[model samples]
Target chain A: MQLLRSYQLLVTWQALRKKAYLPLMMAVQTLFSLGIVLGYPLLFPTLDRTTIYLIATGAPAISMITVGLVALPQTVGEQKTEGSLAYMRSLPVPRLSYLVADLTVWLGIVIPGVVLGVLVGAWRFGLDLQVSPLVVPAMLMVALTATCVGYALASTLPYMLTVIITQAIVVFVFMFSPLTFLPSKLPAWLETIHSILPIQAMGEVTRGTIAPNEFGLPPGAFLVLAVWCVLGFGVTYAAMTRRG
Target chain B: MLLQIEELTKVYRTGTRANDRISLAVGEGEVFGLLGHNGAGKTTLVNQVVGLLRPTSGTIRIDGRDMIADPGLARRLCSFQAQAQVPIDGLTPRQAIDLLGQLRGSSKLEVRRRRERLVDALDLGEWLDIDAARLSGGVKRLVAFAMAAVSPGRVVMLDEPTNDVDPVRRRLLWRQVRTLADHGAAVLLVTHNVIEAERSVDRLAILDQGRVIAEGTSAELKGRLGAALRLELVLSSDSADAPISPFPGSSVSVGNRLMVGIPMDGAGQAVTWAESLQRAGAIEEFTLGPATLEDVYVALVGGVETGPAELEEARSATAA
Candidate 1:
């Protein structure tokens, strides 16, 4: 077996056993996102359920990605400083495995995010969340891809810098993506920006399927995300392989 | 080979050399002590052995498996008790042991069997139910040691095994190390406390600035000194803290261990020191053992230059 997968699994196990708070935070975030979606029905009762579904799906998936990119790094950074990283390295387990394990656990953390997005969209829009047999397979793809990206980011720079940059970029994109008239109707540069951001891909794909036609997602969004998965994985792989 | 490290060199990216061209071997049933002062590359070498830090160039073979090339196989063969505290604040010591055992692929029955015995031997009974973060630094070090012993592996590498431990427990820790070697696990001990090494180590290596300057058995190393002993004495009371002629010699307290030097040249003086201690009821034990590994260390590493007057000072302080 490749050590990378072993590392990912080990990191996942460590988080489950030692850092249980990570998952609890994920649960809370997902619940809050769901609350936002559910509350929309009462506040904007005039709008049709389909439109409400679109907003709910895009909003929470974006939030989950943002939390994962930002919060995860600070925790990992603290561990590195306290010498836990050195302690684990002293074990027989490969250093790469430790990195992988951390990323894998982060992927598991986002499950609550997905559930919130799905449930909110379903209830508000009256759409079919009746567990598409496809959900599992799609989610599995999204998971491995997200981990490849997250772990890659986690290892590339020092933890604090990664967390800061990740939060700034994630929040900026989330708040501004909807306002970028290009994603719905404008310029080449802005469209290019929308084309590659993982949140945008998530919003487009999720919205395209659940409420239908809100983000004006073209087939290009899937292709862009696929490129990201491949490139994110390559970058992470290259970065970790280069480290001592 | 229990352990065969060949041409192990670690040069950090910043051009600092931590470990430079080191080679070593340890056979089963032997306790090998690696001595070095702080920042002397002792921890660096040990860390590489356990796969904590990758070496710039070299091969580490434990039980005939290359640790760098096949780390998982290496991990399976070795148990590392590091100097740093293990983070298992979420679990009790018992649960921590169980979790580590499971991680090592031990059966539940196997874990239970080993834990029951080690819990008492390491004096972990008092802290079994407590969270690791709540453990005192000494207790946490013991906990780390216990975890190393909790699972059975072919090679055991312990960094500073007796640091912060009481003398009574230090004795127990050395006995446990000897027992581990006796049970056929090659033991690697990294320590700066030469006095402890005097009584315990089977063979030793003195490391200086990432280099192994001297390596040999304690007796072989000490034999180079011809005839001299590192002696230390302790008085029974507070008034005894005042320096006086116990045996007309000198001694110093190195943490809990009293340090003194005895010269064979003054046969009458040595006798007087022993007799005075026995007479005053100040001496708990007046032993004339052969020169220890510490003497060998001072002789070879620091160069032997202790004087008769210093010895007298030590004797009086310990006797007083």
Candidate 2:
């Protein structure tokens, strides 16, 4: 509960939203739903709409991962710049508890971005996200895993350079990850690499839930995701707790 | 003891000792001044007292609770208003005060009743809805102090409380501080502003390089330096130079206004000198006065002296 309403996180969220990052991403999401979603079926009348629906439902997996990798670092970097990090430590709460609140707030924000992406995919592509309700928890697990991975990278990098590296990684992983197209479309070696990447797990999980037959992810994606979550948590927690 | 420090020592990582075996105690109803130069461990001492930093080897107790063993309990008894503004940029002034009070365990009714007076006194009606980042520097400072005083912890440690405040409001702030102390809160003020120190603090501890060089009333500290007399002189007019030569060794000029200094006295000579200056018309409008905190501050630390007049000069210089 303390982690939910921390002063720094609230202020940081306001600052981030005002930066036009969230609004701009949201705008793109709305367009994706309205244009490619409805316009695609209208433009290609001969194309089968079920597969198109499947593609639309899963297409945003890559974009969500891209935004997550790039935008999440701004959260931690803003805290450092605002001087509230030191002030927060000055309070009576245990250092770890305060940091946990920061992590929780950033993780919370990712939910909206991911959900918006998925919702637009559903509404525009004309395919129902036909996964079991159980997939909601499974999808959350993938988001949590991606969150930790992004947090680790952000915390370890310097504030000025955080944006650059995060943007680069977002682009790098979005290009190669197997969630967008079929895994068999990739060369066999690249297919192995995609299984372990943070974004790849989310992509695979979303595609598997939405269209399990054509875009089946390997069973080991979950194992790779768990490993990423644990390692990311360890690295980021160490970075936040290091002595000022 | 409202506050206690025993052999408080804070040594920086590079081996320079910021605080060196300092110890002091302030009972309730006391406004204690911690005076020091920029690197004189004033803030380091304040930080430990407020639990922002731990003593390298010493212990701090607030309201008799060991600060380290149960820090949350200790925090209940004390609040720290730091020199740097604690940035609560998105919060409006009214919300900021209420939030601070709530965080410190004040009841909703208590916060509701207390916040109105604070809002009015701080003249924050205009800023009550504006976020802190949008307010001016002085306004943010007022908010910080108001937040520290919302519940009036048993001990409130203020580091340079008057920074970014105008002179008219500084007096108002000191009055508020006195009211808090009179109500039984132990107030610790850390500052380099000797004028503010002279006029406000009931007791002062001059800290030199992390050690208490002297601790007493302003009069006691000045009296120790040597024989001193309070010299007072009225201005001939708003603009005439009030002869200040007769009062030797110290002077403070508030404006084209009164000048006074308690000169060092060895067997009452400072008095005789004041009379002599009176006779010579150097101080045509003259009376002997008491020594001040500025005098004590200069004697303890080697530097060019500052009185209200010099401060006036410095202010004009910056303006020019």
Candidate 3:
């Protein structure tokens, strides 16, 4: 009964709190995803089919990552500054329920953009995408892991620091990470970092699921995502439940 | 007692003691006030009771259940209105109140019923559907109060609940607070408003520098002042400091205001002296009234005094 009440409270409160901005956020995500899919090709004179597939599948992953890492942290930081986070903490609900509810809301927000980005990517590139059945679970896992990591960051750090870190993560994901290109092309040390970090794993899983014939599923990718997901949740739980 | 706090102490890592061995109790159906100035640990004590801050030492028990061992139970049993305003930017007052009521485990219908009652009681009918972000600060404060009162648990803790409320609605809000206590919940009101606390609380504890200096009902606390009357002087200018007392009593001066406690028999003398000071252009106005909790507060808190040079200069200027 306690669990049910906690879930109810968190889900409803979170959803309502973001109600005015959800549509705008979804539109922004969709526009951002579309920009990546259609605009990236302008940089390269001629793209190979594999490169096109990578960019196509990469757009959705980046969208999920942006929402999770960039948007979620900013929202949570605002809540912190506004004292709403403390108000929520004072509620009788279970602490973990807050994380679940936030994840659920963010996932709902990211799905429209992901689906549209995938369709638009396939249409623009004229590719017969061999979308695997595991795509749903792959995308959900990527979204969840990104959001949990962001939630943990927002919960633990001061609001201004959280905002700064989130902006830095955006730059890292866009410029340094292997989301839009092959990991082998990067330097060895950075490649190793991507191998351990969840960003590359997120891209790999989504790209592999979307174009099964084009790329083989790395055995370690799912494992990496699972580990990061757990770690993120553990940190977030500790931060939320700790009395200070 | 529904809420019992014994020697509750909270020391931050900066080595600042926000609460120093504070002990108090509030029984069911009572409005207990923790009255203190800013940084006097009133909000700190409330935060600990709601389990938002863990106390460094001592114990807090809600209905004899140990809160230190299980802070979750502390949160579950107490509904708190924090000193900071609750952010409800997108939500309307009705939505915020209803959601909070449901969050506290009330059924939908029950929550709706209680929300309606609070809306009427707090005169929040017009602001019910307006976005809270657009509401006036006082209206938003009323919304926050309704949110807490809608599903007040075994204990309700309001930290400076009347901060931004207007005079007319503040009366309404106080009535609602009384109604909450009358419903058998222990209401712990934390505020520095001496006048409101005196009238609203069944019992109150005056805290200064993290210590409870006095605790009692309004009449009981005021009884300590005997038959003294308070002589208030509003100085003519900010630079004008309080003159040395002509009578045998204590006085507290803050800014351009001065409050001196004089015996009841000295009221006529106090008025004559105040008139003289007014004619000397040292004071803009003066009032003499029965000693209030404010006088007791000044006597206990020993408020800051202007420098001797400043007082002497103002006195010499008045004489000249």
Q: Kindly report, for each predicted structure in the order presented, the TM-score of its chain A compared with the true chain A.
A: 0.74, 0.75, 0.96
Supply candidate 1's per-residue lDDT for A69: 57
For model 3 the local lDDT of residue B131 reads 83
The worst-scoring run of ten residues by lDDT in candidate 3 chain B lies at B311-320
Work out the iRMS of candidate 1. Answer: 12.1
Q: Write the per-residue lDDT of candidate 3 for residues B1-320, one digit (tens) a residue.
A: 98999998887655667788999999999999988777787877887788777899999999999998888888889989987888777888988898888888898999999899888988889999988878988888889999899999999999889988999999999999999999999999998789888889999999877888899998888777664688899988843457788877778786788888888788888999999998898899998888888888878876653323223222221220
Number of clashes in every candidate structure?
Answer: 22, 11, 0
User: For candidate 1 chain A, which ten residues in a row score worst on lDDT?
Assistant: A178-187
**RMSD each, Å:** 8.8, 7.8, 6.8
Q: Of the pair 2 and 3, which is ahead by lDDT? A: 3
Give a tens-digit lDDT track for model 3, residues A105-135.
8888877778877887888888898799999
Please give the ranking of all candidate structures by lDDT, highest first, separated by commas: 3, 2, 1
What C-alpha lDDT, on a 0 to 100 scale, does residue A22 get in candidate 2? 47
Ranking by DockQ: 3, 1, 2
RMSD of 2: 7.8
Shift in Å, residue A31, candidate 3: 2.9
Per-residue C-alpha lDDT of model 1 across residues A70-107, encoded as one tens digit per residue: 55555555555555655665555555676557666666
DockQ of candidate 3 compared with the true complex: 0.43
